[model samples]
Structures are given as structure tokens and as C-alpha cells.
Target: MRLERAVDDFVVQLASERGLSANTAKAYRSDLDALAAFAGGRGAHDTSDLDLELLRDWLWQDSRSGLAKSTIARRSAAARGLTAWLAREGHTTADAGARLRAPKADQHLPRVLTRSQVDGILDSLAALAATGDPVAVRDVALIELLYASALRVGELVGLDLGSLDRSRLTVRVTGKGSKDRVVPFGVPALRAIDEYLATARPKLAARNSAEETTAIFLGARGKRINSRTVYQLVASLLADLPGTGPAGPHALRHTAATHLLDGGADLRAVQELLGHASLGTTQLYTHVSAARLKDTYRVAHPRA
Candidate 1:
């Protein structure tokens, strides 16, 4: 069987059998396509020609070209999965990439903001809210709840009016793995949301097509806000902050989780709040929390 056919099968397998989201399945397809192209370059145009040595060479080329270790590891996993599928389908006699070793990815701790830092960012948003532009209220609310709930940008933008329970202070979120969890937001987020609802959302909803009006957040054009718009909004906000590093919606999520842990929230409880399935996934916040502790001690201990 051709690599293209195998990739089509794998994508279907990911969507139907493995229960992957459409975007995730698309990413796997892309990775497999890249792997197939690399295999073709190495004279392994088909499953029969693909072997461990050829796969390693492909990974080597990617590493030498400055691709991240995590990316190369993911490509190797894609190859291993494809070759295993080929063997199971009897398209190949054996899985060639099954024994291939992948490089270890760096596990650096995520950046988190201090309480004062978070306050400053939100204060800046509040200043923008004072613009009385109505949309400014919505942007402030968007950033507030994103950090308050630690939601992925998809979940934040995908939010519908029906998904929020103001009485319960929880919002129903569909997270990764297609799992739904009710996440709680703090009073600050609630205040921001109230301002948006009272002033901004109504104004935006008025101009939008009735058919496209269910979303909680609206763009300047009276439609659902695109993910890229949200990304640029967050990037613009963070660009003025003190830290010079990667900043997006996920930075707020990271900041929220670390702050929750620093405030002495239980690890499992924080995981549940973040909708993380694994406690290990939530454990990274500990590194952030610990760094804060060390910084405080170093400043105040006076133990020269």
C-alpha cells in the first residue's frame, strides 16, 4: 500500500477509533505527510522500503535543521505508528520503526506571573476598559476569565452564552480528549464578565447576523471572535509586560495554575480545576511555585 493510503487510514483511525478531535487528527496527518516526504528523500518511498535506519536519518536531518527535539520525537512517533499500522494491515511484513529510539524532549518549567504582576496586567486591562468603547470591557473580561479559569484559547473562544452558569459560578468546558468539566472562576472574572454582558455583548450582538449569534464573545465585526484574533489580543497585552518570553493565552493558564498552587491549593484539586487528566501534567506548576518560594527566601532570609 502507498504511504498516502496508509495516512488516510491512520487519520480515520485517529478520528473514529481513537476519538481524536478533528484538529488533532489533521495534525497527525500533516506529521505523517512530512514523514512520508522524508522517507521518499531517503529512498524509502513505500512501507516495504521504510526501515529503522532510514527513519533515523530522517530525524537526523530534522535535528540538524534546528527543529525542536519535541518535534523530531513526534515525527518519530508518527513513523512508528504508521509502520505498526502497515504491519497490522499486512501491507508490510514487519514494523520497521517499532524499535526506533526517539530523542528526549526538554522539560523546562513554564513561566508564571507573580500576584502583583497578574494584578498589573489586569489593571492595565481595566484602564483600557475605562475607554468606554464597550469592546474594551469585552476584551478585559476575555482575559480575566481565561486566566481565572485556566482555559485553552479554543475553550475560551468556543464559549457560548448557554455554557455559563452565573448562579453557580461555573462554566461547562469541553477540554482536550473531548472531556467536559465545569470550571470555577474567581470574583474578579465575574466582575469583568458582568461589565461585558451589561454593556459590550449587547452592542456587538445587535449588528451580527442572527444565525451567527450564539457565541459569548463577539469580534469587532459582530461575529464570533477568531482564535488568531484572541492570540493577537493576548500577544499585544503581554508585549507591554516585564518578561520577554513567549506569551499567549496559555501563559495566562500557566500563570493561573501556578498561582493556584502557590496559594496552597491541593495538587489534585488544581488538576481538576485545570481539567488536566493526569496529576503529572499538573505537577509542572510545582516547579513554578518552588521558584517563587526560592526567590522569596533569597530576598528575605538575610543569611549571608
Candidate 2:
């Protein structure tokens, strides 16, 4: 089979059988497409032409091109999956890229906001919301719920009207892999959501005459809010803050998780709240906490 044809089939399987998210599937497609182009140039146009040497050469060339280690690692993983699938499906006699490896990506600590910074952000948003602008009200509610529940931006935007259980102070969100979980928010988040639902959502929803959006968060156009809009809102809010990492919605998430750990929240409980698939993923916040503690100690302890 042609390399391109084999790649297409594997990506389809990733979506249809493995149920990977659209973003994940798109990333795999991009990686595989690049590999296909590279292989074609090297005269490895067919499945049989994809041997261990050609795969290693492609990755080596990518490394020499100065691509980030993370990108190379992801591309290598994509290639490994493809070759394994090809071998299993009888397109190839063996998994030629099974032993291929790439440099491990460097792990940078996530940007976390101090509690005072979080309070300041919320206070500023609350002041804007007091103006009665529908969008401003919605933005306050969005940011509050994000920090309160440590929700992924995708999960926050995916919320529907029925997703909220106000009586229980919880919201049902569809997380990664289409898994559903109920996450509890604090009274502050509930109050912000109440204000938004009562004062803002209807006004925004009325923008479209023929249709009503069931989404909990609405754009200015009375449609479900997109991730880019949420990203822009978060970036603008975080822009002036002291941090080096991304100023996106996930920064609020990282902040929330770290704060939870600092306040003596259990590790397993936090894992459930954040919808992480692994405890190790949740443990990243522990490292953040330890780093903060060391910073505080160095500044306050005069014995050094």
C-alpha cells in the first residue's frame, strides 16, 4: 500500500476506533503528512519502503532542522503508532519504527498565580460585571467557574444549560475522550453563574431570532463561545501578570490545582476534580507547590 494511503487509514482508525479528540487526530495527521512528504522525497513511497532506517533518517533530519524536542517526540510517537498499526493490519511485514526514539521534551513548570493575584483578577472582573454589560457578566462567570473547578477550556465551553446542578453546586462537563464528570464549584462561582444566567445569557441568546443556544456560555452573536474567544479573554486577563508560560485558560487551571494542593487538598481528590487520567499528571502541581515553598523559604530565611 502507498504510504499516504496507509497513513490516512491509520488516522481514521485513531478517530473511529480509538476515539481520540479531533485536535489529537488533526495533530497526528499533520505529523504523518510531514513524514509522508519526507519519505516520498527519499524514494520510500510505499508501505514496504518504510523500514527502520528510513524512519530513523526522517526523525534525524527533523532533529537537524532544529524543531523543538517536543515536536520531534510527538512526531516519533505518531510514526510508531502508524507502523505498529500497519504491521498489525498486514500492510507491513513488521513494525519497522517500533524501536525508534526521540529526545524527551523538557518539562517547564506551569505558570501559577498567587492567591492575591487571583483575588485581584476576580475583583476586577466583578467590577466590570457590575456595569451590567452582558458580555462582561458572562466573562466574570466564565473565569470564576474556570478557577473554581479547574476545568479545561474545552470543558468549560462545552457546558450546556442543563449541565449545571445549582442545588448541588456542580456542573457536568464532557472531558477528554468524551468522558463525563461532575465537578463542584464554590459559592463564588455559583453566584457569578447565577448572575450570568439571570442577566447576561438571555440577552446574548436573543441575538439570533430563529434559534436558541443551549450552551452555558454564549458569544456576542448568540452562539456557543469558541475556544479562541475564551483564549483571548484569558490572555488579556493574564497579560500583565508575572509569568513566563502561556497566558491561556489553562493557566487558571494550573493556578487552581496548585492552590488546592497548598491548602491541603488530597491528591486523589484533586485528580478527580481536574479529570486527569493519571495521578502523575496531577502530581505536577505538587512540584509547583514545592518550588513555591522553596522560593518563599529562600526569601524569608536569614540563616542562609
Candidate 3:
């Protein structure tokens, strides 16, 4: 079988059978496409031509080109998944990537905001919301829920009017793998959302001439907000803040998780709240909390 066709089939299986998210499937497809191009350059365009050596060489090339270890590791995993699928489905006689290995990605703690920093951000947004601008009010609600529920940007934008349970102060979000989980938010988030719905959402919804949208968060066009728009909103808010990592929506997620841990929230409970499939993924926030404590101790301790 042709390598390209094999990759296409593998990606389809990832989505259809494995229930991987579209973004994940797309990422695998991208990495495999690059591998296919590299193999084609080396006169190995068929599944039969793939070998363990070729897979290793592909990773080596990426390393030589200065790609981050994490990216190279992801590529290696993608290659392995493709080769394994090919072998299982009889496209290849054996798994070429079964023996493939890549450097372990460096583990850097996710960026987390200090409580004071988060408060400053929310205070600024609340002040802007007080101006009675519809978009400004929506921004307040958006950030509040982001920090409150620790929602992924995709999940946040995907929220519908029916997703909120105002009486319970919870939201029903479809998380990764299309799994549904109800997560609770604080009263602050509830108030912000209530205000947005009462004052801003109607004005924004009126701008849409198309079929009415059920989306809880509306863009300026009165349609469901896109992830890029949310990213832009967050980036602009965090641009002037003192932080080292990405200024995207996930920073708020990291902040929410770390703050929860610092305040003594149980790790297992946080795992469920963030909708992480693995508790190990949620444990990264513990390291962030510890790092912050060390910083605090170092700065305040009288003895070095």
C-alpha cells in the first residue's frame, strides 16, 4: 500500500475508532504527512519501503533542524501509531516503528498566575464591564468562567445556552473525546454570566441575521465565538502582565488548577474537574504549587 493512503486510513481510524479529538487526529496527520514527504525524498514511497532505520532517520533530521524535543517526541509517537496501525491492518508485514524511540521531552511547569495577578486581571475586566459595553461585559464573563471552571478554550466556545445549570452553579461541557462532564463554578462566575446574559448577549445576538445560535458566548457578529477570537481576547489581556509562557486561554486553566491545589483541593477531584483522562496529566499542577512555595520561602526566609 502507498504510504500516503496508509496514513489517511490510520488517521481515519484514530478519529472513528479511537475517538481521538479532531485536533489530535489532524496533528497526527500533519506529522505523518511530513514523514511521507521525507520518505518520498529517500525513494521510500510505499508502506513496504518503511523501516525502523527510516523512522529513526526522520527523527534525527528533525533534531538536526533544531525542533524542540517535545515536538520530535510527538512526531515519533505519530510515526509509531501509524506503523502499528499499518501492521495490524495488514498494510505492512511488520511494525516499522515498534522499536522507534525519541528523546524524552523536557518537563516545564505550565504557566500559572499568582492569586493577586489573577485578581488584578479580573478587577480590570470587571471595571471594563461596568462601562456597559456589550463586548466588554462578555469579556468579563468569559475570563471569569475560564478561570473559575478551568475550561479549555474549545470547551468554553462550545458552550450552549442549555449547558449552564444556574441553580447549581455548574456547567455541562463536552470535553476531549466527546466526553460529557458537569463542572461547578463559583458564584463570581455565575454572576458574571448572569450579567452577560441579561445585558450583553441579547445585544450581540441581535446582530446575527442567520438562524439563532444556541451558543452561550457570542462574538461581535452574534455568532458562536471562535477559538482564535478567544485567544486574541486573552492575549491582549495578558500582554502587559508579567508572565513567561503563552498568554493564551490555557494559562487561565493552569492558574485555576494550581490555585485549586494551593487551596488544598484534592488531586483526584481536580483531575475530574479538568476532564483529564489521566490523573498524571493533572499532577503537573502540584509541581507548579511547590515551585511557587519555594519561591516564597526563598524570598521571605531570613536565613539563606
Candidate 4:
């Protein structure tokens, strides 16, 4: 019934029932632990003993300690989750703190690139592929698949050569929380992968200290390509093309999702491709789609 023991139970519940990522569990645990520590000196040693005023005092301490708004919101959520679980388990008679409020946080719009800009970027990569540099070919494939499939950088780089079905034009990638999904790319990505495997990979492998790496994408040293390298590569490529914003791998992801929605792809299908557990996460793209729609209407409609 102690505070720490309750956190342990909550973590187990999260892991067994909620399927939260380990990092996510750690974050929630930290929030709960801080609350436990805050309430430790007080008489509130367990869930039943805690009160709404105690919860408010904890949040006040967080504010005085200079936690960010987002952080405070998360802590508030942690408090609510704990109380909810306690009520469900019959430790508390009612969810007294359920009505408690959290701080209002700033919202930022996700930046996405135009489809034409993506085409231009891929065209530039195609030129690099024509140089007969197999790595350059692989680079083209990597960029193409990333934009085409809307893969997270981790999902893209974590891919193994064995998981790719070039005949089907699909690659199996494990997304966040180790959930697997099959993502398809275009023929251009296929051709790039082929060239990389046939020419560039062998050359890079021959230079390796070991036999070879199973990584579908290899570095200059013939090991699995890492996330940082992919991020840098995308940034450098976007730098050469003028007027792009924050050209990380995620920008490609946002661009792909936005373009899918723009091109009449169903929201549910795109959600599956993007590995979102909820359609609500996918629905954010609808806002992007609607804004584009309004812009198009303003230019084309004479209804004013």
C-alpha cells in the first residue's frame, strides 16, 4: 500500500495491459516517483490517505521547481492515472482528483513539404544514382522509401536485408513499441536497392573487418546505417535544395502522410502505414489536408 509499491503495480499494469514503450513507462514511473517522494514526508503513505489538496501541493511544487508546461501536464496526467487505477482497484472510494486541471500548453504545427518538392528532391537523388556509385543508388532508395512509405527514421534504419521482399515491393519494419508493419515502396526504390545489393554492398563488405552485416542499408564501414547518419544525409540533401524547413527524416514522414491525405488516400489506410496505434494521431493530417483544401478553394473559387 506504500506509494512506491503502488507505482510498481501501476508499471506492471502499464506493461501487461497498456503495452507502453519502455521509455514511456520510465517517464511515467519518474513522475509517479516524484509524487511519492513529495508525499513521503506527509501522512499520505498510500493511495487511500492521499487527498486533492495534497495533489495540488505537489503540482505547485513542480511549478516552483521550474518544470515546463508540457512536463507539468504529464505529471498531472500521472497523478490522474494513479488515482484512476486506485479507484478501479477499490483502494479509493471515488476518483476525487479526476476533475483536477492541468496547465494549458502551446501547440505547434507539424511542418510538411510539398509533393512537388519531394519529386524534385528524388530527381536530384536520381542524378546521384546515375554516377554509378552504388552507395548513391542506395541513398536514392533510402530517401525514396522514407518519403514513399512514411517510415520513422528508426523503422527505416532498423530494417534488415532478410525482411525485404523486393518481389512484392514491400519491406517489413518494426515500428515504435516493436510493432511490425509491412510498408511498400515504388519501383524506383526497388531499383536502388537492387543496385546497392549487387554492386555497392559487395564492395563495402569486402572492406569490412567481418564477413558482412545483415543491415539492408550499410554505412561506408559496411555496418548497419544509424539514425544520426540518415538525419544528417536528409538535412544535407535538403540544404542543397533551397527553402526547406527542418529537413529531418520525420519531415519526410509528415510529407508522405500529408501527401497521401491530399491525394485521396483513406485516413485509416495511412494510419496503418504510419504505424499509429490510434486514428486520432492520423487525424492530425486531416487538419493539414483541410488547410490545403481551403487554400486551393480560395485560388479557384469565384463564389465571393
Question: What global local distance difference test value does model 4 have?
Answer: 0.84
Which digits, one per residue and each the tens of the lDDT, describe model 2 over residues 1-304? 9999998999998899877888889999999999999999998899999988998898899999999999999999999999999999999899999999989988889999999999999999999988999999999999999999999999998999999999999999988878899999999999999999999999999997788778999999999999999999999999998878989999999999999999999999999999999999999999999999999999999984
Tens-place lDDT per residue, model 4, 191-245, is: 7778778878777666677666788888778788889999999988777665435
- TM-score comparison, 3 vs 4, better candidate: 3
Model 2: per-residue Cα lDDT at residue 290: 99
Which sequence of candidate numbers ranks them by lDDT, best first? 3, 2, 1, 4
**Lowest-scoring 10 consecutive residues by lDDT in candidate 4?**
104-113
**What's the lDDT for all of these models?**
0.85, 0.94, 0.94, 0.84
How far out, in Å, is residue 20 in model 4? 2.7
Give the CA lDDT, 0 to 100, for residue 42 in model 1. Answer: 66
Q: What lDDT tens digits, residue by residue, belong to model 3 across residues 60-161?
A: 999999999999999999999988988898888999899999999999988888889899999999898899999999999999999999999999999999
User: What is the lDDT for 5 in model 1?
Assistant: 76
Instruction: Tell me the TM-score of model 4.
Output: 0.79
lDDT, candidate 1, 199-276, per-residue tens: 998888777766567789999878999889999998887786776446888888999999888888999999999888
